[model samples]
Target chain A: MAHAADRRCVVIKADVHLAREGFTMDVQFQAEGSVLGVFGPSGAGKTTLINLIAGLEKPHRGSMALDQQTLFDAAQQIDVRTHQRRIGVVFQEHRLFPHYSVTGNLLYGARRENGDLDRVVTLLELSPLLDRRINQLSGGERQRIALGRALLSRPQLLLLDEPLASLDLRLRRQIIPYLRRVRDELRVPIVYVSHDLTEILQLTDQLLVLERGKSVGCGRYGEIVHTDAVLSVVHDRGMNNVLVARVLEHKAEDGVSVLEIGPREQGEPTGRLFAPLCAAEVGATVSISIRPWDIALAAAPVSGVSILNQVRGTVLRCTGHERRMLVDVNIGAPLIVEISRRSATTLHIEPGTPIVCLIKSHSVQFVGALGPGSPQ
Target chain B: MTPEEWSALLLSLRVALWSMAIMLVPGIACAALLARKKFPGKVILDAAIHLPLVLPPVVVGYVLLLSLGRHGWLGGWLYNSLGVEVAFTWKAAAIASAVMGFPLLVRAVRLAMELVDPRLEQAARTLGASPWRVFATITLPLALPGVLTGMVLAFARSLGEFGATITFAGNIEGATRTLPTAIYTYTQVPGGDGPAMRLMVISIALSFAALIASELCSRWLTRRIGAAL
Candidate 1:
């Protein structure tokens, strides 16, 4: 019973110390999951953490271990060579060999003894792209091939460093499903490093938040975002409230998709949020992101309001900085509502006060097609 | 052309080809090391590789003679242990050419190696390739155009070699007498204008052909590697 946690997953214990270009990186964290997201802003040692894990770069002094394997132990002078580490990496630039065809690039690192080449090729939908030259593939296609190639390498752990950062919004959406499939079907343990909070949440709930070469926090997105200091850093990026919901009904005439926030039994009417017409099956779960500015607080239910989503909740707290005020309303999930000081004072919004929160269906962005694990 | 002239042309081609062949692997190895690696004697090694480019060709030839001649250190070892004689022979001419051309070969390949993004090599490393395999598959193929350019440059330099070849090989007729050495012989002798002029035209034609061939080959290689994104 004492070792029950050790058997379920691989434990990545990283205590890395590296210095480059006047920036010294001394960050440490333990990640245990199928997909651990490394969250950080630009130049915050996000990629550095990934590089050290993949053995692309060595730490000046530290020890790294994965699932009982000693990767780098500076004290013992034990550094596993990159090739021998069996850790696959998909760089942000998607570094596919230009001289090779799609299939050649995919098979570059594939293991002859035990590599699932055809399965990955099919999983990432790479059959039509096998014979094409790398130059001919689009940005999304290149990333798919890169993902397939890394998976074909038969790595014990896959490190993806902002695999969709270089892509546009459309391309990012296109690649998110492939990432979900990698996690769900293949069930390979992955370390996904990204600066985008929403994108990170799309793939996994567990995260290691980094700031300026230091790990500020590491936990579920719902838990780590509550810290006052962590909230301030994330606030600078206009962070939004996210809720895991499942699609219930898609009405084309209304141009809205009804999504339930919790498990919808036969008669248990759970909270339902509506978003614009989304390409989701009737029972599929999705992560919806609502910007704080789009949420409106009301003292009572009012008609003639064009907004579709109205949830009853209590005001947790209200705080203001500069010209914006953040009103935390507990609507099943913590939803931050941005409002002017005039309205906060006029409505007399305070902690423990019952309120009705209204948000337009159009404002609710369906950001991610999460697997069945979502929709609590 | 007379048989003597024909022989000079053929001997020059042979020496140049031999020189390029001798430096190919070592040239790329030196270039890869100089461009990608940081070692204790890096700057010193770089300066030594480029010594022939800066110092006089005759000085390089003298050094080669002292170190590689029959009675010289390495030359003595080679002759005594391996029964291979290299002083004042066509092999000596080729050695002289390789030495003078060494700087050019390394410079071109080094520049190409530098242009290759180290990230690509790192990507290959993370994809389960050994360091040597990464160099062979990613680094070598990407730098192919530059490698080809360096080889052609070294071959051209060897073909036109005069000071180093004459100083070390002694210009033996029908053996070490390459095109440039033969041209020098004609120019020095009285009433040698006919042979010298004929050889001059032939030398220009051959040099141009070599240049055109090198250009085409490098362009083809670049096309095969595809343009950098």
Candidate 2:
């Protein structure tokens, strides 16, 4: 048996053409360990990218590989069939086999090899529903089974095409944590496709932005979210900064946790960000996502403020949009703060201005812990 | 009823039952081939399978007679090598009925095959089931209702066959005589109405029974498969 560390990367290089409903997709990219979120509008070929990787559709011209194992190479005349590729696919609609019991579907892939089955059932919280028929399962339950089914395949990589896209917001919220859990515990690389920005940001670190069947951008979400080009595509709505933070102290009595933000390279920016105290224990690593619009910048560090987070940084760049001004500040790393254009002109904020970035600590949403062996 | 009427009734039942049974395997084979597999000349094969449905029954009977009659080339070889002479025999009448009933069976089976979800078979394939195994376990079980419907339809069609039966296997008492042929014989004779009416009633009952049986079997099998409407 090989450990997770021994596995290879998934490299997809394709220039595929599919004509449908007056839209065409000509995409190509590759990823490894990091969850590569394919983000785009409907019919932009985000799902098509996953389909090509899953072997559900063939490319017109391309070479795809995983850890040097050639999956598809037009020049080499090699195309491995879907079933033999040792990859698991979770489709948009939960594609659970209606004829089989939950256990049957979960074991469908596992049975192809001789391995322990009980462990998978327990890990996925599927023990109770094992004997239940798929037709009897709720939509949420069906997706859980679909996830478990894909996991049990012991795939080298997994491809999920908007697994939660069909569910209601509450259901999507309910499944996000499970996805994060899977990503943290399992070493397999995942290629997830979704238009939901929050869901993708909450679950994945790496992202591949797609538009009109072309790859527009690819990188860590936190690093790319601040770029003017990426923000222009993201439309700079509620999307903001994703910071790698640690719980320096948790004051349960005050119902707040002090998160250490800004890299040690910048001598820690001299202030703390207040966040939800319930999500973590003291000294645990967590991800804090704060929308750019929620952050307020002032020229002076004011006293008697109700806002719990006040960080001092120098503005690196500023770009004015129709109703808002996007300011990039380098505290330790670049953070994009979206402010009203009126305020930017009134405060006279510009590049190289020393200012205090103020945000209500409660705006921080804490995501899951950094996985073991994760590079901080 | 006269002895002739009784023999004809028995002969019709025998020929229809034997004809349905004989056509079943080939009918399913043809339907499966048409439904699941793609090949060169597929359109031609489909048209050929359905020829009996479109052509006049007399034409099909004439074609059969030309190919299988005792003096025909294939017919002569069978007679000389195996001492098999099908012309004017009850077996020849059964063959004619089977050919006429074939398209009905194939149509029913093919429709059923189409109704089954292809994804189920693909799931089976991913589960490590071979193509043949997938067909047996997933395809055949799901398609059972259609197969049963086809079988009943073929049996009913064979029970009522007249033109093809007479054309290929000439009416002869206790040999090639069937219900329709006997009815013809009685109509041609003097004061034969009583026997013909009784046999006609029996024929009607048999046909009705076959239709009812098909309905019940389709319901039962559909329920057994637990298929959602």
For all predictions, the C-alpha RMSD in Å is: 4.5, 5.5
Q: Second chain TM-score per prediction?
A: 0.96, 0.96
| Clashing residue pairs, backbone N/CA/C < 3 A, model 1 | none
* Each candidate structure's count of clashing pairs: 0, 0
Across residues A51-154, which tens digit of lDDT does each residue of candidate 2 receive? 67766677777777777788888788898877777777777877665555677678777755556467666556677788776666778778888888888878
Clashing pairs for model 2 are none
Candidate 1 versus the native: TM-score?
0.88
User: Fraction of true contacts kept, per model?
Assistant: 0.75, 0.08
**Candidate 1 total steric clashes:** 0
iRMSD, model 1, in Å: 1.4
User: What are the runs in model 2 whose C-alpha is more than 4 Å off?
Assistant: A1-9, A184-186, A226-229, A236-288, A298-301, A311-336, A339-356, A365-376, B1-43, B73-94, B117-143, B170-202, B220-229
